[model samples]
Target chain A: MFALILPAVLVVAALLVGPMVLLARISLNQYSATQLMIEATTAQNYLNAVADPYYRGVMLTTLVMAFICTALTLALGFPAAYRLARMESRWKSLVTVLTLIPLLVGNVVRAAGWLGLLGNDGLINATLRGLGLTSEPLRLVYTPGAVAVGTIAVVLPYMILTLSSVIESIPRAVEEAAANLGASAFTVFRRVVWPLALPGTVAGCVLVFILCMNTYATAVLLGGSQFKMMAPAVYDQFSKGMNWPFGAALAFILLAATLVLTVLGTALLGRRYAR
Target chain B: MGQVRAGPGPDTVTREAVTRMRAAPLSPLAAPALAGPGLSVRLGRLAFLAAVFLAYAIVFAPIVMVVVTSFFDQEIVTFPPDGLTIRWYLNAWAQRDFARGFLTSLQIALAATAIGVPLGTAAALALVRATIPGRGFINTVLLAPLAVPAIVAGSALYMFYLRAEDWLDMDIKATLGGLVAANVLITIPWTVRLVTASLAGLDRAAEEAAANLGARPLTVFTRITLPMLRPGIVAAALFSFVASFENLELNLLLVGPGRTTLPVAMLSYLEFRMDPTLAAVATAQILMVTILMLVTDRFVKLSRIV
Candidate 1:
């Protein structure tokens, strides 16, 4: 096992962890991007990140947005997943294919597409206006809502695919057995299949939750500078903001948060299902 | 592959069609004998599926619109233009560095897949086939890369490349090799997971039998396991290749001067000007993605690969 995966392990370690420690070191150092040189170590950058209220807001908003998105995905996802799992006709395969098509499109294209869809003179607003639904173009573009919409669209596929596969695994005999013993479809579903598929649902929810938390593209494209998220803030601090130590601190903190979620999710979901 | 025994069970007509199946098999034909999802709850689910379909339509509308808007020569962003024209496609095609950018992206993506897929498969085989100590811990640690946001990944790559240049006193950032190095790291998990799943479900008997029969391990592997693993490796390589091609975030951070992938170039252009021509470029990208998704889906089932 070790030998087969040795090369992949090395590459990931060198690219992922090596740079993380390097960034940590750079973050601690009085790094100079201009001269491209670093002075000896200092704690100033870390202090700036923790002390600043602006950075605080960024972290808070990111966490809040991630959770909100996760909740929205679950709420919207459950019914669709249930329907897909119970699908009749030859359409089940088509539906499965349809759900996955979105994954093929890159984030850049997806974000750009949303810009057109939600812009002031975009089709959505135009349709709304034509229907006399509103007087003015409701600040649809460049809002937190737009960010949520884009994020949901991108992440929805993962949620649906994961949840549906789990749902499909529920044996019909168990449901029939429940119904045979004087249970309705709903009762049988609630009592049996729901519990059976809970692992997949939980896994999907956990994955979505973490991806949303780690997200940067949707935030950058939809929220812009004002509607901050944790990942993008970490990004700006390193790139445009030009504060290495603070950025590194934020990155470490974000990494820590994701790790916590993964552990909790595994304990809560994976170990129980044991699939 | 998962198999479903078509037709209803214990039927003279349906059973004649097939011996056995899995899941609720489709009736040989839609007949009065068949029942839909329960009538009481059936409407509810149908309505829900309809709503989901509408949502899917909304999600897909942008790509559809881009394809429509791409043909516009109006030069301005508008829905109902003067008339549909194909001039924008020509302009997009002839645009400076756009062709070069496309070639660069293709080259980088191909090179990255060449390195990444085999390494990932090797990793998967090692992790799954061997009784290595701490294999689970090592696999999780390796996949931890995906948990990091692309921005951080890009930043790390940029910084590393910069330092490498400093140490070697040679340019490394703008080169194809640098792009491959960054993308290979990003795409490894996909190939590893795909190959590992394939390996896990694989028939080990052929190789074992071959070894006993006096065929060398290498010969057995080439004849038996490699043929079986080909579907998975191809699918993984294709998926990783497409991803590498369209990767904007990492490229945005690490793509050095004088050479930019198509996506990074489009992003830079859009940062300054948003035009219908960009839509043309976007349409071309969508076309590539459509083909890629089909190819990958055919070779490897997404559910199993992950």
Candidate 2:
């Protein structure tokens, strides 16, 4: 048993845990404008992260974008997932495969595709122009809206997949029994299906929220320089600003935020499940 | 509502009859009367399904547009493209650096999958069957990389690799080897999740029977357990390879000049050019994913993974 698990454990230790330790250590180092970092212990990076308006604004933007993206994905995905769970047709597998395509395709490629569709001279504008609806192209490409759309497209499939499995677990007889008890269909759904599906909703929202918050490619290629998010900001600090300490601090904060949310969401929903 | 249930009157009897009618299985005579849902219900369902299909359509539009526009004859990627031709596919093909980068990505993905699948399968087996201490800790740690932001993982690994060379006199950074290590790290999550899920649903009766029949442990595993795990192994291999192949953030940091992957190459190309060549490459990738999905769907139900 030990031998069977040794290889994976070693890889994770060396790659995942070791680097995380290094990241934490780096986060404590002193930053220099001339040199990248000096081997001095300080909480200055974390302090700056908390005290600076720029960093605070970036964190707020990241949080809002993630929240909005999660809500949008759940809104778009729930009905589809509900339908998929109830489907008895032979084409269900095909639909499942179709839903998985966006996930399988690379983010860079998907963002590139969005550039073509959302650019000033791209599809949406071209259509509007051809129809004479507008004489000018709309600036849609490098905006928060583009980031939201791209992120939702990236994470919606995951939401649907999660919700579909949960909804599918619900027995059809329960819904029928409620309907037969003189309850209207809407009432049956509201009281039975909605509550039963809450666990899945929580799980999907948490996962999608994390993915959205950590999104790098969408924010980079679509959001451009005007929009800043946590992941891209971390990248900028480390790569361009040469502030490894600040970057590590930001990354850890992001991880902590995600971890706390996940734990809280699970605990809250797990209690509801118990009741 | 209170008056209706007040007594065991006509209302109570009518409600009981309605319950019995609903609970009863439909006979042949009753089947025609229950031919389908009511018209209003059917219409509502139709509208629901339409909305569902529309959502999928929007989800798929970006990828579909890439594949479609790759065939456009125009130099720039604009909508309402002029002329239709397959010229851009040739352009995408003729890019020597891109071809080389693609080969590098393929090599990395293959190597990562080769290492990841078996190691991940072994770990999953241990997680499911082993009585090792801290099993929950081991499982969570193994899957922890998935939750780490990609850029964070990349930077951490990048810094670690740089320091490792200084400390140990071994250089893996900026090489295909280091890239493979990062790929394997990310790919392990997919392999472990899929294979563990598969193993959880498996019955151990065959293995137990084989062991009782005087078969050695190795023989039982080789002849029974491994065979049962083939579908899962295949699915894991596909997912791990795709994960490695589609990786961009990790490779962006680790890749040096002339040592990039396909996605990284496309990103750099986009920096300098705005042609449909990138679309052509994406279409090719889309084709590859389609073929792999079709093949995997034949062996195991794709929906089962969910």
Candidate 3:
């Protein structure tokens, strides 16, 4: 067992904690492009992040967007997941295959697809124009909506795949018993199936939410020039802004939020089943 | 019965025609003939599925657009093209950067995989079997990078490199090795977690049986465990390749004046050119991915890769 798990532990230690520790240690100072402009033993970076409205707003909006997109993916994904659990394997295989194809394509590719679709001469606008729906093209690209759309596209597959596999593993006799006892399909679904499938669904949700919270590619391609999410904001600080300390501070805060959601998601999910 | 009559049958059909139609090929309208009171629901469902298929096409339109626009002979890409040509593909070929970038990417990805796969496989084995000190912390940390947006990881690495360059007496910032190290670190989680799950599902008794036969631990692991873990290993390799290749956020952070990966090049090209040539590049990428997927599916269980 130690043999099996030790390497994983060390790798994680190096990648996750080691870097985070390094970031936290660095966050206390004034690291710049030229050098670590060390103002040792100062909470100035954290203070600066908190006091700045622009940075705070970026954090808030990032949370709001992540939360909403996660919710939407869950909602949209649920029905398909339900269908996967309830349906026969032949149809399930086909639908499941279709759902997962997006995963093969990278985040940038999918985001770019949305960009092309939402562009001025793009499909959506062209269609709207062709139908005489609008005299002028609506600006749909490079907005929050596009970001959400792109994020959803990226996350939807994982949710469905994880949820369906979990849902499928559930004993059919349990669902069948509910149906056999004169429970409506809805009742069987709500009372019996959903409770059983919650573990996988919730797990998938939390995972995607964490992912959405940390997303960069989707936000960059779809949100375009002006819109800023935490990931991109963090990127800007490190690269364009060249303020590593601030970036580190902001990263720590974002991590805290993600950690909280992950805990709540897991605990709530586990306890729900426990009862 | 009502839906059957409402379907796209012969509007001018007579009773005699209805009899003859029964003998002909079953039309799409014949769906209602099979469904009962659930006919409306079934039709609605089929419509919804059709919508999903349409959305699938739309979701993948970038790839489609890229392919169509790449072969375009004319300079500008409009709806109807005047001619079709392989000019862009040749142009892409002409770009010396692609060859260099491709080779660099290939080298880095391969190097990362060679290092990452064993490390991940061994780590997965350890993770599944051991309940050591700081196990929870380790588990969390190992999987933590998945949560760390790649850009942040890249940034952190850049900072680390900048700060520690003198200490390590090494230059990693904007270096190929530096980039590879960062990517390998980020992608390690996926390979480890995936294999860990697969290993957990595998039976241990087989190993026990081998042990009972007095086989050495190394022999048992290599002959039995390695072969059993082949599928997961293949998947890990594919995913690592894809993750490494598709990486842009991290690459953006560390990409130097000269060391540009394909995606970085494409992003830069799109910024200035905004031409079908970028589309051509994108198409080439999509084609590579799609072909990879299909081949991966045929050989390895594609599910395992992700």
Top candidate when judged by DockQ against the true structure: 2
Backbone collisions counted per model: 9, 0, 12
lDDT of 1 by residue, A190-268 (tens): 6676667676777788778878887766677777657888877776776686756667777777777777876787686
Please list the residue runs of candidate 3 whose C-alpha ends up more than 4 Å from where it truly belongs after superposition.
A1-12, A31-36, A86-98, A131-133, A265-274, B1-35, B38-77, B80-84, B96-99, B129-137, B204-206, B298-300, B303-306
Between prediction 2 and prediction 3, which has the larger TM-score? 2
**Per-candidate iRMSD:** 5.8, 9.4, 11.4
lDDT for each residue of candidate 3 in B142-196, tens digit (9 for 90 to 100): 7776667676677667777776787898877778777777777756777887677
Task: Residues B202-223, candidate 2: write the lDDT tens digits.
Answer: 9999999999999999999999
Q: Score candidate 2 by DockQ.
A: 0.44
User: Candidates sorted by lDDT, descending order?
Assistant: 2, 1, 3
Looking at model 2, residue A136 earns an lDDT score of: 88
Model 3 Cα shift for residue B155 (angstroms)? 1.9
lDDT of 3 at B35: 35
- Could you tell me how far off, in angstroms, the CA of residue A42 lies in candidate 1 after the best superposition? 4.6
What is the TM-score of each predicted model, taking all chains together?
A: 0.87, 0.91, 0.84
* Candidate 2 CA-lDDT value: 0.81
RMSD of every prediction: 5.0, 6.6, 8.9
